[model samples]
Target: MEKTRAILVDITKCIGCQSCEQACKQVHGFPMETEARLSPTALTVIEEHGDKFVRRMCMHCEDPACASACLVGALRKTATGPVTYDGAKCIGCRYCVVACPFSVPRYEWSKLAPLVKKCDMCAARQSAGQLPACVEACPTGASIVGWRDEILEEAERRILGDAKYVKHIYGSQEAGGTSVFFLSDVAFEKLGFAAAPQQPMPVLTANALGDVPTVVMVGGAVLSGIYWITQRRVAVADEERRER
Candidate 1:
Protein backbone atom coordinates (compact mmCIF):
# COMPACT_ATOMS: atom_id res chain seq x y z
CA MET A 1 0.00 0.00 0.00
CA GLU A 2 1.13 3.54 -0.67
CA LYS A 3 2.17 5.58 2.34
CA THR A 4 -0.17 8.13 3.88
CA ARG A 5 0.89 11.75 4.53
CA ALA A 6 0.95 13.98 7.62
CA ILE A 7 1.98 17.50 8.58
CA LEU A 8 3.86 18.08 11.82
CA VAL A 9 3.50 21.61 13.18
CA ASP A 10 6.31 22.67 15.51
CA ILE A 11 4.75 25.50 17.46
CA THR A 12 7.99 26.28 19.27
CA LYS A 13 9.67 27.24 16.01
CA CYS A 14 6.84 29.36 14.57
CA ILE A 15 7.54 33.09 14.39
CA GLY A 16 3.92 34.06 13.75
CA CYS A 17 4.91 35.43 10.32
CA GLN A 18 1.48 34.50 8.76
CA SER A 19 3.27 33.37 5.58
CA CYS A 20 1.35 30.09 5.61
CA GLU A 21 -1.95 31.94 5.85
CA GLN A 22 -1.01 34.17 2.91
CA ALA A 23 0.04 31.25 0.74
CA CYS A 24 -3.19 29.41 1.54
CA LYS A 25 -5.23 32.43 0.44
CA GLN A 26 -3.24 32.78 -2.80
CA VAL A 27 -3.63 29.12 -3.70
CA HIS A 28 -7.36 29.15 -2.87
CA GLY A 29 -8.07 32.51 -4.53
CA PHE A 30 -9.44 34.14 -1.43
CA PRO A 31 -9.22 37.91 -1.94
CA MET A 32 -10.24 38.92 1.58
CA GLU A 33 -7.89 38.21 4.43
CA THR A 34 -9.49 36.52 7.42
CA GLU A 35 -6.96 37.21 10.16
CA ALA A 36 -9.23 36.04 12.96
CA ARG A 37 -10.72 32.63 12.17
CA LEU A 38 -11.51 30.05 9.54
CA SER A 39 -14.25 30.99 7.09
CA PRO A 40 -15.58 29.66 3.82
CA THR A 41 -13.11 32.01 2.11
CA ALA A 42 -10.18 31.21 4.42
CA LEU A 43 -8.73 27.71 4.66
CA THR A 44 -6.27 28.50 7.43
CA VAL A 45 -5.62 31.06 10.14
CA ILE A 46 -2.92 31.76 12.69
CA GLU A 47 -3.89 33.13 16.08
CA GLU A 48 -1.77 34.58 18.90
CA HIS A 49 -1.65 33.05 22.35
CA GLY A 50 0.52 35.61 24.17
CA ASP A 51 3.89 35.29 22.38
CA LYS A 52 3.01 31.90 20.83
CA PHE A 53 0.99 31.56 17.63
CA VAL A 54 -1.23 28.64 16.81
CA ARG A 55 -2.34 27.75 13.32
CA ARG A 56 -5.82 26.32 12.80
CA MET A 57 -7.18 24.25 9.95
CA CYS A 58 -9.00 21.00 9.38
CA MET A 59 -7.55 18.26 11.60
CA HIS A 60 -8.44 15.61 8.99
CA CYS A 61 -9.41 13.14 11.69
CA GLU A 62 -8.59 9.50 11.02
CA ASP A 63 -12.25 8.67 11.60
CA PRO A 64 -13.76 12.05 10.93
CA ALA A 65 -17.01 12.92 12.65
CA CYS A 66 -17.82 15.18 9.71
CA ALA A 67 -17.66 12.25 7.32
CA SER A 68 -19.75 10.11 9.63
CA ALA A 69 -22.48 12.73 10.06
CA CYS A 70 -22.66 13.45 6.35
CA LEU A 71 -25.99 12.02 5.27
CA VAL A 72 -24.85 12.18 1.63
CA GLY A 73 -21.20 11.12 1.77
CA ALA A 74 -20.04 14.50 0.45
CA LEU A 75 -17.17 14.53 2.95
CA ARG A 76 -14.85 11.59 2.77
CA LYS A 77 -11.58 10.67 4.51
CA THR A 78 -9.24 9.62 1.74
CA ALA A 79 -6.82 6.72 2.08
CA THR A 80 -3.95 9.11 1.43
CA GLY A 81 -4.74 11.08 4.67
CA PRO A 82 -6.68 14.17 3.58
CA VAL A 83 -10.36 14.61 4.27
CA THR A 84 -11.74 15.83 0.96
CA TYR A 85 -15.04 17.47 0.18
CA ASP A 86 -17.18 17.07 -2.95
CA GLY A 87 -19.40 20.10 -3.52
CA ALA A 88 -21.22 18.41 -6.39
CA LYS A 89 -22.41 15.71 -4.02
CA CYS A 90 -23.06 18.09 -1.13
CA ILE A 91 -26.75 18.71 -0.47
CA GLY A 92 -26.06 21.76 1.71
CA CYS A 93 -26.67 19.70 4.83
CA ARG A 94 -24.44 21.26 7.52
CA TYR A 95 -24.44 18.19 9.73
CA CYS A 96 -20.72 18.01 9.08
CA VAL A 97 -20.34 21.47 10.55
CA VAL A 98 -22.14 20.46 13.73
CA ALA A 99 -20.36 17.10 13.91
CA CYS A 100 -16.84 18.45 13.64
CA PRO A 101 -15.03 18.50 16.97
CA PHE A 102 -12.66 21.23 15.81
CA SER A 103 -15.34 23.32 14.06
CA VAL A 104 -13.21 23.29 10.90
CA PRO A 105 -15.84 23.07 8.17
CA ARG A 106 -17.16 26.41 6.97
CA TYR A 107 -20.44 26.96 5.11
CA GLU A 108 -20.78 29.71 2.49
CA TRP A 109 -23.71 31.67 3.85
CA SER A 110 -23.59 34.40 1.17
CA LYS A 111 -23.41 32.20 -1.92
CA LEU A 112 -26.36 31.18 -4.07
CA ALA A 113 -25.08 27.62 -4.07
CA PRO A 114 -22.99 27.18 -0.95
CA LEU A 115 -20.53 24.41 -0.26
CA VAL A 116 -18.70 23.30 2.86
CA LYS A 117 -15.04 24.28 2.92
CA LYS A 118 -11.81 23.25 4.69
CA CYS A 119 -8.21 22.45 3.93
CA ASP A 120 -7.56 19.35 1.85
CA MET A 121 -3.85 19.64 2.69
CA CYS A 122 -3.15 20.28 -0.97
CA ALA A 123 -3.82 16.75 -2.12
CA ALA A 124 -3.39 17.76 -5.77
CA ARG A 125 0.01 19.28 -5.05
CA GLN A 126 1.15 16.15 -3.26
CA SER A 127 0.11 14.04 -6.22
CA ALA A 128 2.20 16.30 -8.46
CA GLY A 129 5.30 16.02 -6.23
CA GLN A 130 4.85 19.45 -4.66
CA LEU A 131 4.49 20.43 -1.04
CA PRO A 132 1.36 22.00 0.42
CA ALA A 133 1.29 25.78 -0.13
CA CYS A 134 1.22 26.50 3.60
CA VAL A 135 4.02 24.02 4.34
CA GLU A 136 6.21 25.37 1.55
CA ALA A 137 5.69 28.97 2.63
CA CYS A 138 6.79 28.30 6.21
CA PRO A 139 10.38 29.66 6.48
CA THR A 140 11.20 28.33 9.96
CA GLY A 141 10.27 24.72 9.24
CA ALA A 142 7.33 24.98 11.65
CA SER A 143 5.16 23.00 9.28
CA ILE A 144 6.71 19.94 7.64
CA VAL A 145 4.98 17.14 5.74
CA GLY A 146 6.01 13.53 5.32
CA TRP A 147 4.76 9.98 5.64
CA ARG A 148 2.49 9.68 8.68
CA ASP A 149 4.63 7.13 10.53
CA GLU A 150 7.82 9.03 9.84
CA ILE A 151 6.21 12.25 11.03
CA LEU A 152 5.13 10.56 14.26
CA GLU A 153 8.68 9.42 14.84
CA GLU A 154 9.96 12.92 14.20
CA ALA A 155 7.48 14.37 16.68
CA GLU A 156 8.69 12.00 19.37
CA ARG A 157 12.31 12.79 18.60
CA ARG A 158 11.76 16.50 19.10
CA ILE A 159 10.03 15.99 22.44
CA LEU A 160 12.77 13.67 23.68
CA GLY A 161 15.66 15.77 22.46
CA ASP A 162 14.44 18.96 24.09
CA ALA A 163 13.51 19.32 27.77
CA LYS A 164 11.72 22.62 27.13
CA TYR A 165 9.16 21.05 24.79
CA VAL A 166 5.69 20.04 25.97
CA LYS A 167 5.50 16.35 26.78
CA HIS A 168 2.37 15.85 24.72
CA ILE A 169 1.86 15.63 20.94
CA TYR A 170 -1.51 17.31 20.34
CA GLY A 171 -2.84 15.31 17.42
CA SER A 172 -1.15 12.02 18.26
CA GLN A 173 -4.22 10.77 20.15
CA GLU A 174 -6.76 13.52 19.65
CA ALA A 175 -9.82 12.01 17.99
CA GLY A 176 -7.83 8.80 17.63
CA GLY A 177 -5.13 10.60 15.62
CA THR A 178 -5.19 13.10 12.76
CA SER A 179 -3.14 13.99 9.69
CA VAL A 180 -1.92 17.11 11.50
CA PHE A 181 0.18 17.16 14.68
CA PHE A 182 1.29 20.03 16.92
CA LEU A 183 4.26 20.44 19.25
CA SER A 184 4.76 23.35 21.62
CA ASP A 185 6.77 24.68 24.55
CA VAL A 186 3.87 25.05 26.98
CA ALA A 187 0.70 23.16 27.88
CA PHE A 188 -1.62 22.72 24.91
CA GLU A 189 -4.70 24.19 26.60
CA LYS A 190 -2.85 27.43 27.29
CA LEU A 191 -2.13 27.66 23.55
CA GLY A 192 -5.87 27.59 22.69
CA PHE A 193 -6.03 23.93 21.75
CA ALA A 194 -9.45 22.45 22.28
CA ALA A 195 -9.84 19.45 24.49
CA ALA A 196 -10.54 16.43 22.29
CA PRO A 197 -11.52 12.96 23.39
CA GLN A 198 -8.97 10.32 22.55
CA GLN A 199 -11.75 8.04 21.30
CA PRO A 200 -12.50 8.48 17.60
CA MET A 201 -15.22 11.11 17.19
CA PRO A 202 -16.97 9.20 14.41
CA VAL A 203 -17.70 6.33 16.76
CA LEU A 204 -19.50 8.69 19.11
CA THR A 205 -21.42 10.26 16.23
CA ALA A 206 -22.49 6.89 14.89
CA ASN A 207 -23.89 5.73 18.20
CA ALA A 208 -25.81 8.95 18.69
CA LEU A 209 -27.25 8.92 15.17
CA GLY A 210 -28.19 5.28 15.40
CA ASP A 211 -30.34 5.84 18.49
CA VAL A 212 -32.53 8.41 16.76
CA PRO A 213 -35.97 7.27 15.67
CA THR A 214 -36.62 6.67 11.98
CA VAL A 215 -39.25 9.42 12.06
CA VAL A 216 -36.65 11.88 13.30
CA MET A 217 -34.26 10.83 10.54
CA VAL A 218 -36.96 11.45 7.95
CA GLY A 219 -37.74 14.78 9.56
CA GLY A 220 -34.07 15.71 9.42
CA ALA A 221 -33.99 15.05 5.67
CA VAL A 222 -37.09 17.20 5.22
CA LEU A 223 -35.52 19.98 7.27
CA SER A 224 -32.35 19.80 5.18
CA GLY A 225 -34.40 20.15 2.00
CA ILE A 226 -36.26 23.10 3.43
CA TYR A 227 -32.99 24.75 4.40
CA TRP A 228 -31.65 24.46 0.85
CA ILE A 229 -34.80 25.98 -0.62
CA THR A 230 -34.77 28.78 1.95
CA GLN A 231 -31.15 29.65 1.19
CA ARG A 232 -31.82 29.69 -2.55
CA ARG A 233 -34.80 32.03 -2.21
CA VAL A 234 -32.94 34.38 0.14
CA ALA A 235 -29.90 34.57 -2.15
CA VAL A 236 -32.02 35.09 -5.25
CA ALA A 237 -34.01 37.85 -3.56
CA ASP A 238 -30.81 39.57 -2.51
CA GLU A 239 -29.48 39.46 -6.08
CA GLU A 240 -32.72 40.95 -7.41
CA ARG A 241 -32.65 43.68 -4.78
CA ARG A 242 -29.10 44.58 -5.75
CA GLU A 243 -30.08 44.75 -9.41
CA ARG A 244 -33.07 46.96 -8.64
Candidate 2:
Protein backbone atom coordinates (compact mmCIF):
# COMPACT_ATOMS: atom_id res chain seq x y z
CA MET A 1 0.00 0.00 0.00
CA GLU A 2 1.15 3.54 -0.65
CA LYS A 3 2.21 5.56 2.35
CA THR A 4 -0.40 8.01 3.54
CA ARG A 5 0.23 11.65 2.62
CA ALA A 6 -0.01 14.49 5.15
CA ILE A 7 0.32 18.22 5.57
CA LEU A 8 2.53 19.98 8.10
CA VAL A 9 1.32 23.32 9.42
CA ASP A 10 3.94 25.46 11.12
CA ILE A 11 1.96 27.96 13.09
CA THR A 12 5.04 29.93 14.02
CA LYS A 13 5.76 30.55 10.34
CA CYS A 14 2.25 31.74 9.39
CA ILE A 15 2.09 35.46 8.55
CA GLY A 16 -1.75 35.83 8.61
CA CYS A 17 -1.66 36.59 4.88
CA GLN A 18 -4.76 34.45 4.16
CA SER A 19 -3.17 33.24 0.95
CA CYS A 20 -4.16 29.69 1.78
CA GLU A 21 -7.77 30.74 2.25
CA GLN A 22 -7.78 32.59 -1.07
CA ALA A 23 -6.28 29.61 -2.86
CA CYS A 24 -8.88 27.27 -1.38
CA LYS A 25 -11.73 29.56 -2.49
CA GLN A 26 -10.29 29.94 -5.98
CA VAL A 27 -9.85 26.18 -6.43
CA HIS A 28 -13.29 25.30 -5.09
CA GLY A 29 -14.94 28.21 -6.94
CA PHE A 30 -16.41 29.62 -3.74
CA PRO A 31 -17.30 33.29 -3.50
CA MET A 32 -14.69 35.34 -1.67
CA GLU A 33 -15.84 35.93 1.85
CA THR A 34 -14.68 38.58 4.29
CA GLU A 35 -14.87 36.08 7.15
CA ALA A 36 -14.43 32.44 6.23
CA ARG A 37 -15.61 29.57 8.41
CA LEU A 38 -16.31 25.91 7.78
CA SER A 39 -19.20 25.88 5.29
CA PRO A 40 -20.29 24.24 2.06
CA THR A 41 -18.45 26.90 0.07
CA ALA A 42 -15.47 27.61 2.34
CA LEU A 43 -13.44 24.47 2.83
CA THR A 44 -10.74 26.14 4.95
CA VAL A 45 -10.28 29.21 7.09
CA ILE A 46 -7.58 31.14 8.95
CA GLU A 47 -8.34 32.41 12.42
CA GLU A 48 -6.37 34.97 14.40
CA HIS A 49 -5.17 34.30 17.92
CA GLY A 50 -3.79 37.46 19.46
CA ASP A 51 -0.37 37.75 17.74
CA LYS A 52 -0.63 34.29 16.14
CA PHE A 53 -2.59 33.07 13.14
CA VAL A 54 -4.04 29.55 13.06
CA ARG A 55 -5.26 27.80 9.93
CA ARG A 56 -8.23 25.46 10.38
CA MET A 57 -9.50 22.68 8.10
CA CYS A 58 -10.28 19.00 8.09
CA MET A 59 -7.61 17.05 9.97
CA HIS A 60 -8.14 13.98 7.71
CA CYS A 61 -7.76 11.51 10.52
CA GLU A 62 -6.14 8.12 10.05
CA ASP A 63 -9.25 6.62 11.66
CA PRO A 64 -11.81 9.27 10.97
CA ALA A 65 -14.86 9.42 13.24
CA CYS A 66 -16.93 10.90 10.45
CA ALA A 67 -16.37 7.87 8.25
CA SER A 68 -17.36 5.57 11.09
CA ALA A 69 -20.48 7.56 11.87
CA CYS A 70 -21.64 7.54 8.25
CA LEU A 71 -24.36 4.90 7.92
CA VAL A 72 -24.30 5.00 4.13
CA GLY A 73 -20.49 5.07 3.80
CA ALA A 74 -20.63 8.52 2.24
CA LEU A 75 -17.57 9.61 4.17
CA ARG A 76 -14.48 7.46 3.63
CA LYS A 77 -10.76 7.58 4.35
CA THR A 78 -8.64 7.14 1.26
CA ALA A 79 -5.60 4.89 1.40
CA THR A 80 -3.40 7.75 0.15
CA GLY A 81 -4.66 9.83 3.11
CA PRO A 82 -7.71 11.96 2.60
CA VAL A 83 -11.10 11.56 4.27
CA THR A 84 -13.29 12.10 1.21
CA TYR A 85 -17.05 12.41 0.87
CA ASP A 86 -19.35 11.03 -1.83
CA GLY A 87 -22.35 13.27 -2.21
CA ALA A 88 -24.18 10.79 -4.42
CA LYS A 89 -24.14 8.20 -1.64
CA CYS A 90 -24.94 10.75 1.04
CA ILE A 91 -28.42 10.71 2.63
CA GLY A 92 -27.78 14.01 4.40
CA CYS A 93 -27.89 12.30 7.80
CA ARG A 94 -25.37 14.76 9.32
CA TYR A 95 -23.99 12.02 11.58
CA CYS A 96 -20.48 12.95 10.48
CA VAL A 97 -20.96 16.50 11.62
CA VAL A 98 -21.88 15.35 15.14
CA ALA A 99 -19.08 12.76 15.36
CA CYS A 100 -16.12 14.81 14.10
CA PRO A 101 -13.77 15.90 16.88
CA PHE A 102 -12.55 18.97 15.00
CA SER A 103 -16.11 19.84 13.83
CA VAL A 104 -14.74 20.35 10.34
CA PRO A 105 -17.75 19.08 8.36
CA ARG A 106 -20.25 21.71 7.35
CA TYR A 107 -23.78 21.40 5.90
CA GLU A 108 -25.51 23.51 3.29
CA TRP A 109 -28.71 24.67 4.97
CA SER A 110 -29.94 26.81 2.10
CA LYS A 111 -29.64 24.29 -0.70
CA LEU A 112 -32.63 22.15 -1.65
CA ALA A 113 -30.44 19.05 -1.63
CA PRO A 114 -27.46 19.82 0.55
CA LEU A 115 -24.24 17.92 0.98
CA VAL A 116 -21.72 17.88 3.81
CA LYS A 117 -18.50 19.67 2.95
CA LYS A 118 -14.93 19.66 4.29
CA CYS A 119 -11.41 19.64 2.99
CA ASP A 120 -10.15 16.46 1.33
CA MET A 121 -6.51 17.65 1.16
CA CYS A 122 -7.09 18.34 -2.52
CA ALA A 123 -7.26 14.65 -3.33
CA ALA A 124 -7.71 15.14 -7.07
CA ARG A 125 -4.63 17.36 -7.24
CA GLN A 126 -2.62 14.95 -5.10
CA SER A 127 -3.52 12.07 -7.43
CA ALA A 128 -2.13 14.20 -10.28
CA GLY A 129 1.21 14.69 -8.41
CA GLN A 130 0.51 18.17 -7.13
CA LEU A 131 0.45 19.80 -3.74
CA PRO A 132 -2.76 20.95 -2.11
CA ALA A 133 -3.90 24.42 -3.11
CA CYS A 134 -3.33 25.80 0.39
CA VAL A 135 0.17 24.37 0.61
CA GLU A 136 1.11 25.55 -2.87
CA ALA A 137 -0.09 29.06 -2.15
CA CYS A 138 1.75 29.40 1.16
CA PRO A 139 4.55 31.90 0.32
CA THR A 140 6.10 31.50 3.79
CA GLY A 141 6.12 27.70 3.48
CA ALA A 142 4.08 27.42 6.67
CA SER A 143 1.93 24.75 5.00
CA ILE A 144 3.74 21.77 3.49
CA VAL A 145 2.60 18.40 2.11
CA GLY A 146 4.48 15.11 2.31
CA TRP A 147 4.28 11.54 3.54
CA ARG A 148 2.71 11.23 6.97
CA ASP A 149 5.71 9.66 8.71
CA GLU A 150 8.16 12.08 7.08
CA ILE A 151 6.05 15.09 7.98
CA LEU A 152 5.86 13.96 11.58
CA GLU A 153 9.62 13.54 11.65
CA GLU A 154 10.12 17.00 10.15
CA ALA A 155 7.77 18.52 12.73
CA GLU A 156 9.82 16.96 15.55
CA ARG A 157 13.07 18.12 13.98
CA ARG A 158 11.86 21.69 13.78
CA ILE A 159 10.65 21.68 17.35
CA LEU A 160 13.97 20.28 18.55
CA GLY A 161 16.04 22.70 16.49
CA ASP A 162 14.07 25.83 17.37
CA ALA A 163 13.38 27.21 20.82
CA LYS A 164 10.33 29.13 19.58
CA TYR A 165 8.20 26.03 19.03
CA VAL A 166 6.43 24.17 21.80
CA LYS A 167 7.54 20.64 22.57
CA HIS A 168 4.21 19.06 21.77
CA ILE A 169 3.31 17.99 18.21
CA TYR A 170 -0.36 18.53 17.55
CA GLY A 171 -2.13 15.82 15.47
CA SER A 172 0.66 13.33 16.13
CA GLN A 173 -1.58 11.27 18.42
CA GLU A 174 -4.72 13.34 18.79
CA ALA A 175 -7.79 11.22 17.92
CA GLY A 176 -5.45 8.39 16.98
CA GLY A 177 -3.36 10.59 14.67
CA THR A 178 -4.36 12.82 11.78
CA SER A 179 -2.86 13.40 8.32
CA VAL A 180 -2.53 17.10 9.15
CA PHE A 181 0.05 18.07 11.77
CA PHE A 182 0.68 21.39 13.47
CA LEU A 183 3.65 23.02 15.18
CA SER A 184 3.04 26.08 17.27
CA ASP A 185 4.92 28.35 19.67
CA VAL A 186 1.88 28.82 21.89
CA ALA A 187 -0.34 26.20 23.50
CA PHE A 188 -2.65 24.56 20.96
CA GLU A 189 -5.72 25.14 23.10
CA LYS A 190 -5.32 28.88 22.79
CA LEU A 191 -5.42 28.45 19.03
CA GLY A 192 -8.81 26.64 19.23
CA PHE A 193 -7.51 23.09 18.80
CA ALA A 194 -9.60 20.42 20.50
CA ALA A 195 -8.14 18.19 23.23
CA ALA A 196 -9.27 14.89 21.75
CA PRO A 197 -8.56 11.48 23.20
CA GLN A 198 -5.55 9.55 21.96
CA GLN A 199 -7.65 6.52 20.93
CA PRO A 200 -9.39 6.50 17.56
CA MET A 201 -13.11 7.35 17.80
CA PRO A 202 -14.10 4.56 15.36
CA VAL A 203 -13.59 2.00 18.10
CA LEU A 204 -16.40 3.50 20.18
CA THR A 205 -18.70 3.95 17.21
CA ALA A 206 -18.09 0.37 16.02
CA ASN A 207 -18.87 -1.10 19.42
CA ALA A 208 -22.22 0.71 19.48
CA LEU A 209 -23.15 -0.25 15.92
CA GLY A 210 -22.13 -3.86 16.48
CA ASP A 211 -25.01 -4.34 18.96
CA VAL A 212 -27.64 -3.14 16.48
CA PRO A 213 -28.11 -6.46 14.68
CA THR A 214 -28.57 -8.40 17.92
CA VAL A 215 -31.07 -5.86 19.16
CA VAL A 216 -33.08 -6.07 15.98
CA MET A 217 -33.15 -9.86 16.06
CA VAL A 218 -34.25 -10.03 19.70
CA GLY A 219 -36.88 -7.35 19.23
CA GLY A 220 -38.28 -9.09 16.16
CA ALA A 221 -38.58 -12.44 17.97
CA VAL A 222 -40.36 -10.85 20.94
CA LEU A 223 -42.86 -9.07 18.69
CA SER A 224 -43.57 -12.23 16.74
CA GLY A 225 -44.22 -14.23 19.94
CA ILE A 226 -46.67 -11.59 21.15
CA TYR A 227 -48.58 -11.70 17.90
CA TRP A 228 -48.78 -15.51 17.99
CA ILE A 229 -50.25 -15.46 21.52
CA THR A 230 -52.79 -12.84 20.53
CA GLN A 231 -53.93 -14.94 17.58
CA ARG A 232 -54.21 -18.08 19.75
CA ARG A 233 -56.36 -16.19 22.30
CA VAL A 234 -58.72 -14.98 19.56
CA ALA A 235 -59.10 -18.52 18.11
CA VAL A 236 -59.86 -20.00 21.57
CA ALA A 237 -62.51 -17.36 22.23
CA ASP A 238 -64.24 -18.09 18.88
CA GLU A 239 -64.31 -21.86 19.52
CA GLU A 240 -65.64 -21.32 23.07
CA ARG A 241 -68.42 -19.10 21.71
CA ARG A 242 -69.42 -21.75 19.08
CA GLU A 243 -69.48 -24.53 21.74
CA ARG A 244 -71.63 -22.35 24.10
The most accurate candidate by lDDT is: 2
User: Which of the numbered candidates is closest to the native, going by highest TM-score?
Assistant: 2
- Candidate 1 lDDT for residue 26: 94
Q: In angstroms, how far off is 48's CA in candidate 2?
A: 0.3
Task: Report the C-alpha lDDT of model 2 over 189-244, residue by residue, as the tens digit.
Answer: 98889999898999986888889999899999999999999999999999999999
RMSD of each: 14.5, 3.3
Using all chains and alpha carbons, the TM-scores for the candidates as numbered come to 0.83, 0.87
Where model 1 places Cα greater than 4 Å from the true spot, the runs are 32-34, 207-244
Clashing pairs in 2: none
Please write out the lDDT profile of model 1 over residues 1-244, one tens digit for every residue.
7678999999999999999999999998888555688888789999899999999999988889898889899889899999999889999979999888888899999999999989999998988999999999999999999999999999999999999999999999999889899999989999889898898987875666677797598999999999999999999999999999
Output the worst ten-in-a-row residue range by lDDT, candidate 2.
Answer: 33-42
lDDT of 1 at 16: 90
Clashing pairs in 1: none
